[model samples]
Target chain A: MTKHKIRKLPLFTLIFFLLLFMAGVISGEPSRVLEQSRQICLSCIGIG
Target chain B: MELARKWVQIVIGFLTNGYWAFPFTRTIYQGPLKVVCSPGLNCYSCPASTTYCPIGAIQQLIAGIRFNLGLGQYYLGWYVLGCIGVVGGFLGRMVCGWACPFGFVQEIIHKIPGPKFKIPRILRYVKYIILSVMVILLPLLAVNEFDMGDPWFCKYVCPAGTLEAGLPMLVIQPDLRAAIGHLFFNKLAILIFFVVWSIMASRPFCRVACPLGAFYALFSRVRLVRLRLNREKCTDCGACHQVCPMGVKFNESPNDAECITCMACMERACKYGAISLEVGGLPLHSSPLRKTTKS
Candidate 1:
């Protein structure tokens, strides 16, 4: 594709999604939260 | 051209674990591995990464609150920033161009067949925004009275952590699967984004997103290393621009903030030898020329 012809996707879309993801984390209902139960902090040698 | 090719080869070899210098037995014992610099910036987290990454060390420092800088006699924070600045002042983003392991991975991923895309020009500024928010703003805000701030980049975004540190540890310990949570997915998504975007664009993250790159870019103009243009030497042929993978226009200026000083343009297009690595006011050139016309 020609450089000039490349459609400029809206920046807002990217921001909106990022903000939404952050909000989910703050709200404590992360849509795709990974279970942190089993992971150990290598430094601490304790489960995170 | 030959020198440039050799330099590129050396860079690739260093980055790709191409080891052949040692004898057979030592080579096997030492392995074809790059040594991980401890308490240094090399990400110890990457699986294919034989070397420890510096960012990871910084994050670990913050996480552990290891302020005994003198005891270890290793000041990682200062050392990392100093290394970056020294290298950047001399070579600009040559580290990103050649030595960065993550850059290597991104280049490989970008080679995949797909509908590649470039972030809109306006959106290119988002990397700075990310640097502000993720690296500076968040870390500053997260700091407690104890002066400990979360390593926001590692916590929120760094794909290197996920690929190098997270996935490997998870793979080793199957029991950790149950603990997987939203953070993992969040980082995974970021990794996927860069991986997919790289296919169409070259080092999108370094060009636009990397805060570290942004810092080095600021010094590109006056840093000991520079690209000089001879206005009188000739035509405004757009050869340099054509060769720059980052889409920098050379005729307009040589030391643009975006210019990585990869020397691809200088090595390939500058028929006049106008551009040369300069330290202080001296040009590292044997031949001197009289003043020429201005561009």
Candidate 2:
């Protein structure tokens, strides 16, 4: 690709991911992450 | 700018870990804010952590993808990946320099005067491998009898988890000590090893082993906001090389993957002011010495 196109890619990627992120939120992924993280995270603490 | 950067890191450190009532409550903060993702690597399991670590959340989602799909769930952590992509696309590794609590801890540990060593350049690729295998592939593909996969990176590795979550949790609840075994010892050893190594080398973990860093690096070539270098103004004095904590040779490669946008070179090293923080081709902070020179 051209230099200009390459430069524009991150912005495009950002918008795309932002939309994807909103989709994730609508799908209740954040709630799931919240639920998992709210606990003691047994494996993270190295106990599980 | 170094002093200013230090203060910023310290403030962000506290802001991200704002749940100080963990000691009084004897548990992590489980408020509604937990759904939001912090840009840097702050362990959610850390009692004071108010936000989720992007890497950890990604691994958790990926690990459970198969099981979740079986249960007819459709989400695949688009939010987490989007969070990562947004930051990485905008600022590259600047988050490590100015926001990461774990990176601040590493910098603090490295402050103690000691003999320093250079990390092997080849080792820079290791984080990418870890990101691919340990963080993504293993969590997605490695399954148990129940068809559920573990967050392998958190389970077997991740010294940050040991420092931010494992040790603190153990301190908070002594009852957890009973379950401690080889895993705890292994993680402890890893943490201690990184602590000592950080003193010897600047950001050994960030440079070599951080999967999050690896992921952000993908956007290095295209990050919208970053430190820009003017080859015309640069004398190629190799000054940026000497001052750079991450060993980035800014002259040779302006937007190197490992360049954390720390501005060490621009702050104190370069006198000509060839480097400046920029966004969308506009100068945000330009040459301190020669700001008057027309661009």
Candidate 3:
């Protein structure tokens, strides 16, 4: 309704997603996901 | 919510595990797509799965190290946690209600002819315990002689793994039969119990057992997408609660951890239009309470 509330929405969303993206980048999550994703998890199937 | 759940299941089905192909080839489709993560508790070992299970990855990360900092090569699985955090923080437990294939299965089962009843409120705490004990603490604490901790949740629990991966894997590779033992039977029994329980209960696993759902529940309050209630518009009617599969009393606590964000209370049950869906404080869907004329 108000300009303040309207401005807050996109700013908040942008900041939130930016923070999550930064966290992922800082933690090397993409590579880890890439590596882990490739192999079929043997233990998940009760093999271990 | 039901239609959305079905649509999500279909889309995810196509994404993670494509339509059936020739049996002469590998039963499980393995490709570059495996690098992605499915929002729900789909098993990675499932021949159909194109993405990794975050829960399985988290347990593996916890168990990969011996906790001896200098001696062991360690990976904390920051990526898995980050992916989970982003998804959970954005959508909360909506993933459980809509995107989870296993949850879809449970929903279908609950539709069968059976006497239905609500589970005890105390049982809702069980998922948090499972997340802490089976998923996190056990893997971090228990280690073998080689110092590799076991994925207790994956091995001992996780009916998703049993149904999607174990059963399918067994069918694909019959030699895995010899590997089947007490642990397998134990997991199978748990799956059977849950399957039957799901028939009688609306969403027993989502309410009581899923660690992934428990993890997402933590973000329900702060997630960007949220259910907003206008007290002024509410008549204190219990229609929303009656429609809620998770049995959440939204009037009491709109952000209750058990809420799956299914929007049933918002779109379907609330005749008063007290409830609305919002993203980042911006109202996306609003149903304003109608004014009653005085005779």
Candidate 4:
């Protein structure tokens, strides 16, 4: 991928995960929500 | 401009992963040290973690079941090996540059005004020694009643634990405060020392202390994401060296283990687009067939 594409990939992924994370938080399953949140945290860390 | 950059860094750092906050607290209510990546050399025992730290996990594994090598072994092996092979392979020390929450903490602290003292050249090896002794040798050699060794770094050092786990818990739980003893005091002192050091140095822990940083440094030369230099187009202006916080002379070796892939020099000094990230000596931007030769 081009540099612009590579950079945009992370941005898009971040937005997608953020939306999923918010949905998980609102879904009312605390354990699953927490797991999703942890995944988002890992994504933010960018190592996973 | 410098102050603006510092403020931007501080704000971004704080918003991204400040441990001393309520959102972090809410996240930790689910589990401690459960975050996939241990930002700094913080121990897993730090209450702020959402996942287990690899170092802490390895130590705990070694301490728990003397060479039985069952579940603990599998878990530790997977995490460490996966981190090295996958994360280290892909990003190299970019994790240190951008992602690590603890690194962000140190960056913020380093912004404070002070005469930063460089650790003596001889003392640079101290972290490797710490890793060999505290991380590897102790757990492998020593045995207690439960066939476990101590988490020496976590117990004795690791400021990340002090700031992220210890202080918060101590504030919240009065009994923990009463139980505080010499061990807590010692860790606190180490934390203070590093905190002070950070104000002067770019990343003292990553430079001289972090075993994980050491691990990543090993792969930096051949990692999938690495700095490339086009020698032909390059005037040896030395701007890259000047911009590097880690004191790397990028022209000598863009793949220097000390280079954290922070892109500061790449952004600032490469007037000719001479420096770029590459895999297998090919710039990531170029077509596979072109295989443009470096200057």
Candidate 5:
């Protein structure tokens, strides 16, 4: 890779890292998901 | 690189759905870790899933909005959507090729001895329809008298939920046996159909049915992590196209919606080093830098 192209790596890496951090901070805990999943969701199971 | 990708797919699958010890437990993992979304098509209802399925979570939020639309009791699943958007915006469908368990299952099935088939190009749009209708619109608009909406995608579709969660639950919970009805049979039928089809075609679900894949494909043109082709270096030899399991015509469109970024096309397929896995134009995986000497 040329030096000009090589310089672009850090920008992409930074964006990727920031996206991960943002996703972690934005999402809520699993309790809600667990509650939904634990039940035999009528819709998901095709009973609805 | 193919073997390495398969290993990554398997490892990520196991890690994302890692409650293997309690494989019979229909109850999802309620730990703090479950708050995070793994970038794949893993079902949250899977007995072994530690992280929540973003797609399922989004559907639930949409369904719940019917009763609480104006009552200030509704949340729009901003977090879940954000998780999906961030990942999709960066990696596109690379997750499908290297991380999704369902995709891995399809890949393995295609290896079975069978006459392969090619899906028509027009059929690729079906997944986008599934994403918009079954996943989004149906959940929001199909409320009943109780103001409850069905997760239409998961209910009538989603073989992942069926194979990972429904089948296991039926086996372990004796009481659930009585509840086995036509609906269960229908879901089983869908799963069987996909499984058999995968044996004869590559990633039929990903290409034609996966809402999550459709969502990610939207970002293919602008994703930070993607396959880049140096047009000047390309000879139109079609070697890269030959190895592409998704049948992406990289010569015409390197960042097409159908490109999965599996790197099969990048790993020595281009004799001129035209194709490479790049992070914003910087080559991450490609042929080694050519040796140059000062004149």
Candidate 6:
């Protein structure tokens, strides 16, 4: 492994996930999470 | 440094669960911050939780993947996935060590005077199985008549949910108490078991059962912010191993997957200045005070 190679891997992984995060925003996923979270998640609390 | 970590834990715990008015209102936070992914395991349904648990959010999204795909909606939980991946890749299990509200709770419980015990090595694999089976596979595969599935891990398994959401919610809402039956007792029993176990063992949940811990462990090798061991300085004295609450041997394997990057090795254990916390090949915190007191 070269010096640049060590840096390259993490840089690429960060870029990929950052892009994925941006894509998620474009897909309106946060709204869904928000909507579900706003509801008192009965199952999450183990009551359901 | 440990004091700084403790303050970070406390501040983050408060900031993440920052709806401090929950006790008076007896209501859950339904604000805009609910959309943000909590890096820690603070319960989404907790009365004061300003941010949502990534695990619960992901499970809920995954549980509806098939149903959404069927309707051409395409709910891949990309935001949650990206959020987790970025954090894991960057910090590994630092979140577990420093920010996790539940882990903090366990650490506090472990402070109780008792003979501490190491978790069995075989049990470490159980967290991976739980992550794959309960968090992903079950939620994605086990759909009902409506083509929707359950957040199996949070619903059935996570004691964090039981402690943070169940008991507190029950206390807040008296009418909801009537709905509790076998499930509540089952979960309560699980919570009690872990609470007692933690008193004698450090983070048994993180060691053996936390799916998020399992996920982050995968990134331990590649995490940018990580520990580096200067073997030349190490004496193989076993000081780091004895001091590790998570039982990682720093001299032998600095990047051990189970390592939470708690820096106990860097801060308190390595009297020889062998271990250092680094970010992208640059040392950020290193060179601990030499031990005058015995380990």
Stretches of candidate 1 exceeding 4 Å from the true structure: A1-48, B1-42, B47-52, B58-76, B113-121, B144-147, B270-274, B279-295
Clashes of each: 26, 0, 2, 14, 0, 0
Judging by lDDT, tell me the better candidate of 2 and 3.
Answer: 2
Quick one: RMSD of model 2? 3.2
Please rank every candidate by DockQ, starting with the best.
Answer: 6, 2, 3, 5, 4, 1
- Please tell me which model should have the higher lDDT, number 5 or number 6: 6
- The local distance difference test score of model 1 is 0.53
The 10-residue segment with the lowest total lDDT in model 4 chain B: B285-294
What DockQ was computed for model 1?
A: 0.02
Across residues A5-46, which tens digit of lDDT does each residue of candidate 2 receive?
A: 225666787898899889998988988999887877787657
Q: B95-137 in candidate 5: lDDT tens per residue?
A: 8998899999999889999898887889899999998998899
Q: How well is each residue in B1-295 modelled by candidate 6, as lDDT tens digits?
A: 8898899999999999888888889889999999888888888999989998999999999999888889887679899989988998798898899989999999999999988788888899999999999999999899999999999998888999999889999998888988987887888888999999999899999999999999899888778888888776788888889878787887888888989888888887778877888787777778575854333
Pairs that clash in candidate 6: none
C-alpha lDDT of residue B238 in model 4: 81
TM-score of 4: 0.71
After superposing candidate 6 on the true structure, give the runs of residues whose Cα lies further than 4 Å from its correct spot. Answer: A1-6, B289-295
Q: What TM-score do all the candidates reach, one by one?
A: 0.65, 0.95, 0.89, 0.71, 0.88, 0.95
Report the C-alpha lDDT of model 2 over B1-295, residue by residue, as the tens digit.
Answer: 8888889998988877999998888889999888888888888899999888898889889988988999998659898998888888788898889888889899999999999999988999999999999999998899987668888888888888888889888889888888899998998998899999999999999999999888888888788888888877888878789988888999999889999988888887777879988776667786567444433
**Best-fitting candidate, scored by lDDT:** 6
Task: Please list the Cα RMSD from the true structure of every candidate, rounded to 1 decimal place.
Answer: 13.6, 3.2, 3.1, 9.5, 4.0, 2.7
Q: lDDT winner between 3 and 5, please give it.
A: 3
Q: On a 0 to 1 DockQ scale, where is model 5?
A: 0.28
Q: How would the docking of model 3 be graded?
A: acceptable
Better of 1 and 2 by TM-score: 2
Better of 4 and 6 by DockQ: 6
- Candidates 4 and 5, the one with greater TM-score: 5
Please give, for residues B134-247, the per-residue lDDT of candidate 4 as tens digits. 877786678776555665665666667677667766665545566677777777787788888889887887778876677666667546577777776667778787777676
Which docking category, incorrect, acceptable, medium or high, applies to candidate 5? Answer: acceptable
